[model samples]
Target: MSDLIELRDRMRAFTEERDWAQFHDPKSLILALVGEVGELAELFQWLPADSAAARVQDEPLRSRVGEEMADVLLYLVRLADVLEIDLGDAAMRKLSGSASRFPPDDVRGQAPEKA
Candidate 1:
């Protein structure tokens, strides 16, 4: 979709602006993703799931979560881009795999692995 390409282009622009193309090679991009995930975790630390839901609307906290999420997605999108992956195709493949792994007729209310 256009949105995906737009995001890819925007991310490229960011790296270009900082002359960070060399540093953003796959290895470092993967590492940066892990760091950003940690930042997301830090924001939710010690919060109960129910309480955590509220943070989604808390401006400052939500901003941190949003940034971290975007960071992860940007790297993932770029990685897929580099690998010539059709993301929509990949997502559909995974969804089909999950459907086989978890048939809706019996998956509901089942325990984690048992599902």
Candidate 2:
């Protein structure tokens, strides 16, 4: 697997090949990320909570979820790359911020929460 730096470059080149940089400004990237997440959620439309919970067990459903997840993360990582942000540093800072909001000791075996 490639490191984030290599992956960022790879993604950049891939986008550049299609002249997509103009469409990937920060605001648009953020919107695209949200839209992809909405698409992911749409997969569970009209399903009961229990059925939604079971969706991950279905391989095809998992693939759809994975696709959306990858889209979200791709935009995020690319946004950071474009903004000259260090992925590791940014992540550590975010995790450090979370430390105050959610103590590691307190979070063990508990459900994750939105930050």
Candidate 3:
């Protein structure tokens, strides 16, 4: 099975074991994901832009950032699982659509326009 499917199964089992399925609805999982992203953002909120990248590469901060990112991924996977969506396939289609919309020859080195 794909890694995403394996992760989804693991997360589902974890939630089931915790009796947390009631709280794993789409809205709740999305909200949890946002909170995790906020936590991840908080790590860089006060950093100097020039040093931000380097700082996250260091000791404790790197681990913290990784944990927060993992949280975000887990919540997102749980959300997709609950919604019966294939996260990887959806991501691939979205990426393919974007590639067609923003051809490299046409949009290279340029920021994408707001829809």
Candidate 4:
């Protein structure tokens, strides 16, 4: 199986072991995912763009950033798993849609449209 599948299975087992599935409904998971993403963003807050990239190469900062990133990914994977969504497939489908919407020739070097 793919590593993401294995990781999702492991997360499922872990949550089941804790009887936490009751707390993992889609809305709650989305909130938790947002919280994790906020934590991850905090690491880069106020840094110049180049400095932010360089910060990840340092010691304690690197480790902390890695932990926050993992938290973000873990929450996202768990959210997808709870919702019975196939993340890899969804990503591929989204990428295909994006490619059609933002044809390279038209969008090359252009800023993304605001949501």
Ranking by TM-score: 3, 4, 1, 2
lDDT tens digits, residue span 1-115, model 2: 3488877988899999999999988898888888988987788777789778786778888898888888878887888877888987779899899888888798977888687
Candidate 1 overall Cα lDDT vs. reference?
A: 0.79
Task: Encode model 3's per-residue lDDT on 44-85: one tens digit a residue.
Answer: 999999999999999999999999999999999999999999
lDDT of 4 by residue, 1-112 (tens): 9888998999999999999999999999999889988988988888789778887899898999899899888889999998899998898899898898888999899987
The regions of model 3 sitting more than 4 angstroms off are none
**What is the lDDT of every predicted structure here?**
0.79, 0.84, 0.93, 0.90
* Model 1 root-mean-square deviation: 2.3
Off by over 4 Å in 4: none
Please tell me which model should have the higher TM-score, number 1 or number 3: 3
Q: Kindly provide the TM-score of model 1 when superposed on the true structure, using C-alpha atoms.
A: 0.82
Candidate maximizing lDDT: 3
Task: Give per-residue lDDT, candidate 3, residue 31.
Answer: 91
lDDT, model 3, position 112: 91
Q: How far is candidate 3 from the true structure (C-alpha RMSD, Å)?
A: 1.2
Q: Judge candidate 4 at residue 93 and give its lDDT.
A: 94
Q: Residue 52, candidate 1: how far off, in angstroms?
A: 1.0
Report the candidate with higher lDDT, 2 versus 4: 4
Among residues 3 or more apart in sequence or in different chains, the pairs in candidate 4 whose N, CA or C atoms overlap within 3 Å are none
